[model samples]
Target: MADETNNPDLEVNAASVSDGAYTLIIADFSDTDMAWEAYETLKSVEDGRSVEIEGVIVVRRTTEGRLEIQKATDHSTKSGLKWGVVGGIALGVIFPPSILGSAAVAGGAGAIVGKLRQRHHNHELEQKLENAITPGHSGLLALVSDPGEIKIRKALERAETIVESTLEQVEADDIKAAAKEVQGAHA
Candidate 1:
């Protein structure tokens, strides 16, 4: 949901980004196995470019064609506890509730999970994410910062399709608020 008014189209490259604290990269793999492999490879990705990978997650379509989070990590953040992309509600907003499609009702969290779709721009973002990862394909979402964006594309060479979006602090704060609401209800 990177302010659809300015850039209506989702871009494959985010070289235009400047001064922003974060760049969100979503890479779709040819197959589910490839995604898992890419996820492993990501851990060792370093090119001296200083592109910090803040958080990352690998998701694949389950047997029923629903998105399933296979692995997620926040890496370096927080005081001690690792931060995760999904640990907040960013990933939740990327995939619509229907795509989650199962006994997702884990009490109040389930109801709050659906709140992402309620936002207009999030729906468009969800549709884009859905389109990128077709049946049997998997997606790797990364929240990165600093320069050398190319390092990410190179590391994700196996990605069949890659899209990058700008995530400003304002939008991130909104996501955090949504996550807190969901957690508060769950608690």
Candidate 2:
């Protein structure tokens, strides 16, 4: 679940990047409680596999479709034809077109490898993109890390559309000013 509280000062957030930790802007929930709830949901997903997401920060965007990201998380997994056949068989049951049925059968021999590979990247990238956007509100999801943040950040930059990035500093005043401008324009 994502926080969708509307804030007049949605863009009044800044990014702080250091050698150890990074700052991410995300949506501003109604209160600390809602933010904490969303954080818990994300934290609980660490079953040891997915790129260890340290935390999730929500910054509201005054603009409609802007996603500001810092460090991107790259998650790539590989599988062979066997998995594709198994998957295609399952899919064919749901989609019973003549071509699709034949494709599913042929996939058993390894034709589905390309399909699965494409799907794998698509799924991973799509998940990251979704994480960046809120359900209703428009904004960005900043993912910060220490040494390993580079790879993650690159993956995000490649996959996402609108990304604004800057070093974190005591620049909340500037951000607040920018937020005011955005709000005024939108209003």
> Which model scores highest in TM-score?
1
| lDDT at residue 113 of model 1 (Cα atoms) | 49
RMSD of each: 7.4, 20.5
Evaluate all candidate structures by whole-model CA lDDT and list the values in order: 0.56, 0.31
Listed in order, each prediction's TM-score against the native is 0.64, 0.22
Q: After superposing candidate 1 on the true structure, give the runs of residues whose Cα lies further than 4 Å from its correct spot.
A: 1-21, 46-49, 71-88, 101-121, 146-148, 174-187
Q: After superposition, how far is residue 110 of candidate 2 from its true place, in Å?
A: 57
Q: Write the per-residue lDDT of candidate 2 for residues 49-137, one digit (tens) a residue.
A: 44444333333322443332222122211211121122222222212222232333222332333333333233333333333444334
Top lDDT: which candidate number?
A: 1
